[model samples]
Target chain A: MFGTYLRRELLGRRRQTIIIAIGMALAIALVIIVNSVATGVRDAQAQVLRSVYGVGTDITITRPVTPPSGTDQGGQGARGPRFDFGAGAGDASGDGSRTVHSSRLTVGFGTQTMAATSLTTVQKVHGVEAASAVLSLTNTTFDGTLPSFGSRQQGGAGATPAPSGGSDAKGGSSFDVDSFTVMGMTPGGRAVGPLSATTLAKGRTLAASDEGKHVAVLDSSYAKSKSIGVGDTLSIGGTDFTVVGTVSPTGSDSATASNVYIPLDVAQKLSSQTGKVSTIYVQAESASAVDSLKASLQKALPKATVATQADLAANVSGSLGSAGQLVSNLGTWLSVIVLAAAFLIAILFTISGVTRRTREFGTLKAIGWSNRRVVGQVAGESVLQGLVGGIAGIAIGLIGVLVVNVVSPTLTGGLSSGRGVAGSMAEGARRTFGGGTGQTGRFGGAFGGASSGARSAAATQVDLSAPVTAWVIALAVALAVLGGLLAGAIGGWRASRLRPAEALRSVQ
Target chain B: MYRLKNVTKRYDAKGRTVTALNDVTLEIPDGQLVAIQGPTGGGKSTLLQMLGALDRPTSGTVELGDASLGTLADSRLTGIRGTEIGFVFQGFNLIPTLTALENVETALVPLGVSADERRDRAARALESVGLGDRGDHRPAELSGGQQQRVAIARALVKEPNVLLADEPTGNLDEDTRDEIMDLLEGLWRDRGLTLVIVTHDSAVARRAQRRLHIKAGKVKELA
Candidate 1:
């Protein structure tokens, strides 16, 4: 009977019902779109950090003591105030014997002040797989001529002397180029800090032999500006260096903006600072090993602050992420507005529905139908409207996301790139575990399977991908149901309060 | 069987104690067709509303069978209204959203009737109202008289012991009103329902087994 009543109400009030449905659909869609984008950003950042910079260590250690005062550190300051890295600090676990240390990136800036010796000791800690020392130099620009491939470039002034050479004599003016953050690393560090070799745009990465060779690998952005290809020599900070490789464009604001990599030894030599490194990158066997290892390292060297890969990523990307969150926050507020609009629309539709059917309700009450049943009939109609509207709104919202992505590619920062990763993980997990295949068989099949497997492998290659589509779908459905229930409650309450006798009376 | 003793209904509308019923005392025996006749605002509808348990009397006792109407909670009163009394209104108050048949089926929903049985019974009621072929029509599609008949059918579908109608033929023309009146009289006689109708039409009042005249919230027997 309820079903029959619901059907009749919907059929009888087509226009009003459709309007309510549309409102619900839009609200659900907004929620889905916002959630999807937020999830996308989080996944994308993790991927670029991991794939481009390998599964970084579970825990990292730096100087236990603050860099002695008066040390002039250059480049961007650590995100937070430099903590006192003094040794012998007590651990949070109240074990007075345990000490904590900072990561290399968190250590004081500048070539001379970074405590490389203190970081190297982490390698001696138990459960330590590998540790590589890194020096991050900021605000350093490469002043060189970029050779354009067009006729316009050919007609312009050719390659000129670099600005730091003290001769603007070549008509190539020093543009005060934007500085990219340069990180110095050794080839052995690549095992723990993996950079996919296939993504190298040009030349080769630094080899172990290239330690003091004054060789550097630049991101595609820097490489493009300097017009310096593999085997090309460029002067940086008064030191001549060979451009041995170029990293593929990751499109991350930080990665694309100013990143360059060079051998630690060579960078130290070029900067005239020997036996000194800026920060150290360490990796543990698993995430679980982090806290214990951090404790041991802190106990061993108390002046340093220890952080996990996720922690460092968050700190480095926090400002950027916060900015993104602001956008998402705005989106959230917009969604709230949409919800308010939905409520208003629901009210209007419901009021109109009630007013239009006043006599009908009166008639129902007159025919031995209780107020509860009459209310149910009215509310059932509202719920039907909400369901249809919610679903439709979600569909439109998804399309909107896609349209925005296409129209402004840079707006979303390649969220679409991560979709492949999500799909492949499911397939890979299914094929490996569901097919009764052992580790060896799974590995073998993954490498040797047919074209489909290759496709799967390609799909699975995302650095960090976790599927959140199910979450999005669930949230949408839940919103729809909630909206429907709310509408029903209000409509039912109004229906129940109608006075049958008054409703049947004719107006004067 | 029904009994009313000194039933009084007062409304405090905008701070005025308007009496819609005053010191009304009456007994309605079983299986009787009675009409409460009055002009506009003469308290006939108020009396019927009180009788149907739709409203509480300001003071007094109303007994339907052995149960007291004044003491029941709202929900309980609703249950009583659904089971024991069926009402037909002047507007033919058919749920516009429902078809002629489904409108009748709504009366059986609270009865916990099975879907098939509910449909069968609703169909039977619609057929009895001379709308068997129009079962699928919504109230909007039916004439005012036909709609009133649908309302009558819905009320009778529950086979209530008492059938109350307020201006059951108010919206219909004379010919249609006569036809509806004939149907109501036939149903009352055949089903032995304790029927009470509130109407301004003297012709309708004359057909009842007993007629009572009401004026200014008071009732008197029209010799």
Candidate 2:
């Protein structure tokens, strides 16, 4: 009887049911769209970071290159590759010009060097699964032509000799300086360093046997720029090293740790910093172990800087970060306001329907229907209306999610750490894990649930996408049902308060 | 089988007490066809309400068999109304959303009857009211006289001992009114029900075996 009566009422009073359902549907759709978009943005930021930080890097350790005070650098530190030229350094040509060539490798400007023993200390730290150290260096080559003053004087009639051993006596001088970044690693195949997030593009990767062999691997982008390939020779600090292979970052927008990669021992020797490393990447055994390990690592290496992925996330700047803030603030409030309004609409409609049916309910009570039965019937109708709305809302919300994915907007995120690890993961996450490969997901357009997010030294441009999951859909349905139940309860209470005699009397 | 002594029902309409039933004492025996006729604003409908156990009189002893109608709890009164009394309102008062059959089924719903049994009995009640073929038609789809028949069927479906009709044929034409009266008379006679009808129409009152007149909350026997 309850089912039949409820169905008939809903079908008979079609307008009320449709109106309530539509209100709920709109609220549900908005909720779905907002939540999915927020998740997508987070995923994009993570992808950017993964390109630079490598997949499993839970912590990064570095120190700043503090310059000596009271110098001409004026407290800001050294500007760049400062070169020293000695007299008679270049060869003189017939054109009265002197050509000079020199190259030097030094620690990168922003980062400091730590002892090689620190890597072992990090490895010994409790909860540390793996650790890798890198030496970041800038190789600058100075090649120039110097002017000769003596040549012009010697060409003049009755000219006297002006200089004894100056290579630029003829006085025709011009010079060119070139620079590129270089990183050195141990070839231990650890899952916590720059190589972990890269794929070998050609030839072979560096092996432990290449420790002091003067072998080098170029970043694919850097190699493309230099037009150098496998078995080619590139000069670093005046020494020609054999290029064994080339590798590229796994993430589309991520950059390699440096322009050139080489064995740590060789990089240390070439840079004249033999016992030092500029950066360390550490992986903890589990997510729960990261905080304690970070504290331990900080205690063990007092001068070194330590940062976790979560901490790095705060350094992300630009529209991606703004989107996250917007989602948490405006989007949440909008959803709440709309949902409350929808519930109010449903409740009002239900109560009014009960009012309109006063005669009918009075007649039922006169014919022996109990108050409980009448209230149940009214509530049943309301709940059914809500369930209908819930179903329609799910369909509509999914369509909204689809639209967002199809239009996949792009957001730029940059980390502000001193090392320029600029791919700060800013906005969305569902594909929050990191690995060496990625594929766009179907339901959410999320890229690589197992691979994305971390910052290198450059900001990354990433596409935002929403995720579609069973739990999210279930949550929508639950919300719809809850809204319906609330409306029904209020309406039923009104119905329950109706006295059969007064209700019937009011009809006239 | 029913008795009322000094029954007084008062209603506070806008801060002043208006007496709906004032010092009314009456006795209605089993299987009697009683008609109560009165002018507007009289105690005729209030008398019917007291008889039907729909309310508690302020100062009265109303009884049906051994049960005291005036002092029973609301739930107990409701139970008695469900099992022993039936009501037919003047407006037909059919649930507009339901068909004639579903309207009749409502009376049995409170009886805890099985679904199939309720359907079977509701259909039979409609048949007895000459509306078996019209069982599937909603109240709005039926004529004025037909809607009243559905209401009658709904009230009688549970086989109550007392049948109360309040201005049942008030909205019908003369011909339909006579037809509905004949149907009610026949059913009362066949089932030996204690039938009570409140009406203003002289024609409807004239057909009843017993007649009473109420004016200004006072009741007087009518010849």
Candidate 3:
């Protein structure tokens, strides 16, 4: 009997059911789209991490130094020597190092440089498949005489004065300018680090033969800024060095911020700090060896901070944790709020509908229909509406995700690791996905060299697209139906309270 | 079959209490046709409601058989109405969405009757009321008299022990009113069902076995 009544009532007044269903569907759809985007971001982060931090690479070691006083950590306007961002590093205090026996020389000032020769010791450790060293020269200027990179107004001035009195113990010299970094890479280091051959934009990687040569490979963005190309000459530290090639790193490739890459031997000779590297990246032979290797590296370089890929990811994500969490859970919280509104509207509409049909309910009551039966009839109608609404909501959510992917621009934002990590990560992604050299080509011609600001901004630009999944669809549909049923129950209870005599007697 | 003792029904209209029925005592035997004649708002409908268990008196007990209806639960009263009584109204209150046959079957809904049995009984009831051929038609498609007959079929399909009619012919012309009255008379005589009717016409009252008149919320026998 209730089923019969429910079918008849819905058929007779379809508009009301449709209106309520649509409201619920809208709420559910919003939830689905938000969750999908959140999931997509998380997945992209993992991919970029694997690319920048080599596959199977377990432990990264670096020193944390306090930024020079008066220098903006934001890195804007700081003419720093660009270092190829190595694996993300950690903090150390007070040159915490203890000498331990090793086959080759191992030196550490923990707060500054480690022995460039430490690579052999790290490689000698069990479970270590490979090891590489990096020497980053910060606050470097282009001899302060060549056209300033990215200025585009060639031969503008003689030399900009270097900042006074900040010393890097490893470089053993004061930087002339704080605009770019020069990263010194070991012969085969490019093959394993963030800015590897795979990520080179327009140049060949530095070779073992280039160790004594003053040839440098500029980062694509830095090359564009200086209007330097392959075979071009760049003056560094008062010596003319021929440009070998330009490289671009994307998606957490922190090293790509380096204005130029030169042989470790050349950098050591120029900086007057022979046989010293600032960071070391180590790869464990197997996944199972990663934990033990991290533990051993920490013990090996007690003063230097050692981190695994997971730890590095945690640090990067920690910087943006609040923002990511806000974005990820925004869907759930928004859905709850909208569902409340939808439920209220649905209930109000149902109550109003029941009120209009008071006489019909009264007639049923007078014909000996129990209040429970009346309630059942009302509830049955509502549940059916909920089911319809849930399905529609899932469809709407899927469509919304598709539309967003089609219409929205790539989203870009810097990580706390600053421009280096962002640039390298972006470059890595470009290479991994086989991105065209449209940007690189434009850098060579129309755009000439992207300004430092444009390049930094480009490094942070990441593609944003939602990846919908079965779980999101199922959850959204379930919520929509539940919301509808709850609204229906309220309406049914109100309808059941109507009295036969009074309802029939009412004028309207 | 029906008894009312000192029945008083009051309504709160805005602020004042309006006495719809005041201190009324009434009795009617089974298988008898009783006409209650009164002007509008003379408690005629209120008295009919009391006997049908559609309402409870504010002060007094309404008894159907030996049980005081005021002592029974609302659900029980609903059951009593389904199995023991039927009602016909002047408006011919047929559910507009349902066909004539469905409208008739609606009375059997609370009885837990099987669908086949309910349908068969409804069809027979429609036939008894001279609407067998009009079973599939909606109330809107039928004439006013035909609609009234559908309502009658609905009321009779339950096979109740008592039938209550409140202004059964109030909306009909003289010819249609006579036709309905004759049908009611036949049912009362042939089926031996207690019939209680509220009417405004003295001539309609003349056809009943007994007549009661009411004015200003009080009733008096017209013998």
Candidate 4:
């Protein structure tokens, strides 16, 4: 009897029922899209970690008690003078004893020189596999004096000096400004680190032959912005260099900010730092070896802080974590809006259905049907509607995700590519079918690929998973059903409470 | 068997008290058709509603069988209505969305009857009301007289002890009204069921075994 009642109600009110179903489907689709995007971002982040950073560094080393005195640190306090090499080296106390600590070492180069080089000795230490050197240089300008059409004209130069402390007369022309961090890599460093030569969007990568040839690679973003490209000549620190390549933008702090890459030997020679170095990077043979290697390095170089690849990646990725969280929070707000809309639509449909069926309920109650039976009939109809709507909504939402992937592949990590499609689809299927078993397998695949590729194409190997899409779909359906049931209950209650005689009478 | 002792029903509207039924004492015996004859606003419907367990008297003891209607919980009253009391209203009260047979079978649903039994019983009840071939027809498909017959079948399918009808033929023309009256009389006589009908029509009141005239919320025996 309940089934019969449900069938009659739905068939009789086909238009209303379809409207409710479509409302639910749209809500579910919105939820699916939001969840899929979040999942994609998370996957991409993990991929970046594995492919570029190699399980990331275990620890980071910095001046343990360096006062927060730099403008970059958001501090306004007076800073100690820029690292003074000569002033700090021979300081002695009054009792004829050296005051400087053995662990503290300072070295400097003139405006025409590079800073330091102690990395090879660090690599020779036990448990160290390879090492790379890094230098932090600011306020240095590249000379692109040759007129390029892309250069923007600054307001006619006044007698005022440039903010970079360089005089306009000294090739500080508006077109000559290029500044970024520079790091030197060894063969082993190239194999163990996240930096990749293939990420070059334009020119050839740095080679052994280019070491003494005064060649450099520019980041793609900077190259595009500055209208510079491969084969372009740039003069840095009174020396000329040819732009051999343009690297793809990492969109990360390091990549977005980096403007050039030159051979470590050439950089050293140009900077006049024959035997001094800045920082040394040591790569462990495997993830498990990180701890032992750290211990051994700590024992050998008691003064130098030993950091693993994991530690560096964490530091770099940490800077972006909060921004990602903000995006996720916005997505959550959107989901709430979608859910609230769904609930309101369900309620409206239910009320309309109940109001239209007022006479029917009155008749049923009049003919010896108990209120319980009436409520059951109504609720059963709602549940059936909800089930149909939920299933249909899920299907529609999946199609929506597919549409988004097709229309804007770059927005979804280029997943529309043949390789990306195969990988993502397989991952999506694995998640759908593998249930609990798939999590580990999927993570292993993503993590393994990331780790192996981190040193080669660090920027392109982001992890891509689709579990969030499934979860969102599930949540959307559950909410729809819940909303439906509640609407049905309210409608049924109202119907059952009506005075049968009053309901039968037509209002004047 | 039903009895109402000192049953008084009152409504409060905007600080004004109107009595629909005031201190009415009545006893309705089993296997008899009783008509409540009253003009509009004379509390006829109120009395019928109280008897049907659809309303509570403001102050009274309404005893139906061994249970006091005044003391029964809402759910318990519903159960009583489902099992022992059936109602037919003036407008026929047929669910427009359901076929005549489906509307008749609705009463049996609360009885936990099997689908087959419900269908068979509904068909039989409709046949008794001369609507056997019209089982598949909805209320809109039937005439005023036929719709009333369907309503009568729906009320009778439960085989209740008391059948209550409020202006059951009020909406019908004289011809349809007479037809509905005959159907109700036949069902009442065939089942030996107690029937309480509230009607303003003297023709309807004349068919009942006994009649009570309601005046200003008070009941008096007319015959």
Candidate 5:
């Protein structure tokens, strides 16, 4: 009997029911899209940080130096040699005179602040599993003629094809010298940060036996700049070294930052800094021992700066972190506002619909239906509508996510953190976990190529890759049903309170 | 059976009190065809509402069988109305959305009868009212005479002990009115169900076994 009444009432006025349901669906979809994107970017950031910081290495110790006045600690206007060591590689630029700015060149080895001797003392600290020091040699100019066999690189004046009608620096006619970084790492070095050995793009990483070979493993950024690849000969610091391999940091913006890497001995000998390093990368035995390791490292080398993974991620996120927080908090408030409006509209529609059926309700009441039964009938109908609306909303939300991805592919995997650690962490996680690898694939067209240019753009730009969990769907459905029931209860309460005689006598 | 003692029903019309039923006393015996005649605003409908447990008197007691309606809870009154009484309105107040058979079946819904039993009983009641063949037609599709028949079937399907009619034949043509009155007379005689009919036509009231004339909220027996 109840089913009969509900079906007749709803079926008789399907247009109105559908209209209300759609309104509720749109509200739910809005909530899903906003929150999903926020969560997706945050997750991407965490992954990128993990890759940049390395899966195993947790504590990083660097030399501390006072920045120039008016410089902020978050890698802004802090341009001295010491501050540049852990910073993302700065961009290279040239004036119209074709003259390169030497000061603006990316500094790979800024001042070798941490002494090379500090590695031994750091390893002896409690809770430390292993520690190695890597030397950064920034602004090291390379010869104009290098990697002579490959196609010219893109972006810089040296690589830019000359204008067809112009007399200036025609392609291949006037070569420009560019500054690059050459990181010198110990064989199987653990201090080189999260650039895992497994993420080797081409050929092999440096081994301890290749120390004297003058062989260099160029990071993807420098490799792309010089068109250098495996088995190519590249001249650095007036010395021609064979490019044995090319490596890119897993999911890191640093992939485009670090220029070249060579054996620590070669870098030490070339830079004339045989016993010094800029930074020391430390691996703790376990996650629980990270704080103790940092404290110990600080006590042992009081002048050196020690940081944990969280600190690195936060520093890397910088502005992105602030934006992410805004989006997250705003999403909650927006959902609340939209939900309240939806509920209000739903309640109004229900009251109107019930009021229109006063005659029918009077008839039913007069026919001996108790007030409880009448209320139950109304609530049942509303809950059914809510379930249907919730399902439609989920579909709409998923479609919204896909549409966003299609319209702006750059939003997929474009987030980067301060030191490119977010990108690095994402890349590293992609390799180690295999799940986030799909997310990085979205960066293929974003950077204009699959493996061309600087994928480091992806290091700072996060993408939406968080899977829509069951909990999100469940929450949406529950809210929809609750909204409908609330409206139904109010309408039913009013309907049930009408006296049958009065209701029957009332005008339609 | 119904007993009313000094029953008075009042209402506020604007700022002043208006009496719908004024200090009325009446007793209605079982198995009797009673007709109530009154002019407009004479409270015949109010009296019928009180007898059907659809309204309570402002003062005094109205009893049906052994239960005093004035003291009973609203729910109990609703139960009594569902099981012991049936009402037919002047406008043939059939739900327009329902077919004749469905209209009749609704009377059994609140009685907790199973679907099959309700359907069978509603079908029999419609057949008894001569609307069995018109069961599938909605009220809007039926003629005035046919709609009234469907309304009668709805009231009779519950097998109530008392049937109350408020100007049941008022909207019908003369011939249809005579047909409806004949049907009501046959049901009262054959089924022994008590009948209370309110009417303004003296010709309709002449056929009843007893007649009550109401004037300005007061009732008197006409010999």
Candidate 6:
């Protein structure tokens, strides 16, 4: 009887049911779309972090970038790689005139060195599953010609040679400096290191057997740009290393952490920083233990900066950050307002329905229907009405999600390991070189050069997709039903309060 | 059986107190067909409300069989109305959305009757009221006479002990009114049911076994 009566009522009064259902449907659909988009944006942020920090690295420890005190910037000595050519180090193929090539290695941009023993400290922390240390360095090769002059007889580095070799008669000489990032890693600890998020695109990755060997791996993009591949030799800090492999980052349009990768021992020895590491990547045994482990590591090494994946995600900038803000703020509020309006509409319409049915309810009450029975019928009708809306909303939501995914918008993100020291590095260089023929002056890099902090920022483009999961659909249905139940409860209460005698008399 | 002792009902209309039923005392036997006649606002409907257990008296007792109506809780009164008393309004108070058969089945809803039994009983009741063929028609599709028959079937579908009719033929023409009265007379005779009718028509009152008149919330017996 309840079903029959409710069906007849809904079919008989089409306008009311249609209005309520449409209202609820639109609200539920909005909720689903907004939630899915928000989740998609968050996932994009995670991808950006993964591209920078490597996969499976839950926490990263680095030394904070402190302000420069006096000549040293970022609290580090020397802003960039310094090539110390001794009195007899220059090639002597000619009398007081010759070609000279010198290479030097220093800490990479946007990074600061910490004691290599910090990796051991991190490993000893409870809940730490694995730890790997990396020494990020910048390799700069300076190729220049010494003019043929009599300056070698007077002094050293700044001597003006005679215009006799590799220079015009006017004593004009040109020098070129080329630089790229190098990361030193444990050959066997790729599970939570700089190479974790990369897939070998050519040849083979660094093996444990090559730990102390002068072997290197190249980033696929860098390798392609330089036209260098496996079996090719490259120079780092004046040492020749055979490129054994090329790898690419897993994220789309993202760059690997460094241009070149070499064994930690060799990188340390050639760079003349044998016991120094710039970053330590740590992985906890379980995801839930990451925060606690980070806290303990931070306490153990108070001077070091410990950051989790969430903290890193906040550092992501560019258009992707804007999208995240839009989703978190506008999308959330708009959906909330629409859903509230939908619930309000449902409540009002149901109340009006009960008001219209006063006479009918009174008649039922007078005949033999209990108040409870009549209220149940009203509630039942509303619930069915809400269910209809929920089904329609799910269909509409699915279509909306499909359209969003098909149109996958591209977002550009910029991820940096730490704050850049380029401005300070440039200032420090001017103070040191006094605007003379500085090796890192012209081709410093995109952001001048973070010679002091060595901050490196990589820009990546990602396609955003709103994924609709089963749980999100379930929530939409639950919300629709909840809206219906709320309206029904209020409407039924109104119906139950009607006095049968007054209702019948009012009809007259 | 019905009994009313000093039953009084009052209402406050726009802040002015108005007494609809004043100290009305009455007794009605089982299987009696009674008619009540009165002018507007003369407490005729109020008296029916008390007799039907649709209301509680302000100052007196209304009894049916062995139970007192005024002192019982609303839930208890609802039980009595569902199982013992049925009301037929002049407006043919059938749910407009329901078919004549479903309208009749509503009377058995509070009885917790199974769907099959409710359907079977409603069909038989409609057949008895001469609306068996029109059972599928909604109230809007049915004529005034047919709608009234559906209302009548609904009222009697539960086989209640008392049937209260408020101006049952008020909306009908002379011929249709006569037809409805004849049906009610036949049903009352065949079922040996207690029937009460409130109307302004002297002709309809003339056919009842007993007649009462009300003037200014006061009731007077007529011979």
- How well does each candidate superpose onto the true structure, as a TM-score? 0.70, 0.81, 0.66, 0.64, 0.71, 0.85
iRMS, model 3 (angstroms): 2.1
Please give the lDDT score for candidate 2: 0.77
Which parts of model 1 have CA positions greater than 4 angstroms off?
A: A41-113, A118-131, A136-183, A191-263, A282-326, A355-359, A362-372, A405-408, A411-468, A499-508
- Candidate 2 residue lDDT tens string, B1-223: 9998999999999999999988988889999999999888898878888898877898989999889999998888889989999988888888888899998998899899999999999999999999889989999999999999998998899999999998999889999999999999999999999999998899999989899999989899988
Root-mean-square deviation per candidate: 15.5, 8.1, 11.9, 14.8, 9.8, 6.3
lDDT of 4 by residue, A1-508 (tens): 7778788878877887787777776777667766876676565554433333322333222112223332522111112113122333433333222222111011111111112334545567666555555432221332212111111233245554322211233323122222233434332245434353226587577776665667877666556666777888766555677888876533332232235566766655565445444444456556687778777766765655555544432222222333235337876687778767866777777777778777767666655567777788877777667766777777887887677565644311211101211221111111111211111111110111211110111123222333444467678778778867977887777777766545445423
> What C-alpha lDDT does candidate 6 achieve relative to the native structure?
0.80
The backbone clash count of each candidate, in order, is 29, 29, 34, 20, 31, 9
Q: Least accurate stretch of 10 residues (summed lDDT) in model 6 chain A?
A: A428-437
Instruction: State the lDDT at A27 in candidate 4.
Output: 72
TM-score of 3: 0.66
Candidate 2: regions farther than 4 A off = A63-126, A137-180, A221-226, A248-259, A268-278, A289-305, A416-457, B5-19, B22-24, B37-46, B57-61, B70-75, B212-223
- Residue-level lDDT of model 6, residues B134-176, one tens digit each, is 8899999998888888998998998988889999999899999
Judged by DockQ cut-offs, the docking class of candidate 5 is: acceptable
True contacts kept of each: 0.51, 0.59, 0.46, 0.51, 0.31, 0.72
Indicate the residue-level lDDT of A260 in model 2.
78
Better of 1 and 5 by lDDT: 5
DockQ of each: 0.46, 0.57, 0.39, 0.36, 0.36, 0.60
B-chain TM-score for every candidate = 0.98, 0.98, 0.97, 0.97, 0.98, 0.98
Model 6, position B136: C-alpha lDDT score: 91
Question: How far out, in Å, is residue B6 in model 3?
Answer: 2.7
For model 4, the local distance difference test gives 0.60
Docking class of 2: medium
- What candidate 5 gets wrong by more than 4 Å, as runs, is A32-77, A80-193, A196-198, A201-217, A220-338, A405-408, A412-468, A506-508, B12-18, B37-42, B170-175, B200-203, B214-216
Cα lDDT for residue A264, model 6?
Answer: 93
Give one digit per residue, the lDDT tens place, for model 6 in A103-187: 7776644356777888888889889998898877777777665555555456566755544554553444545566677788888
Which predicted model would earn the best lDDT?
Answer: 6
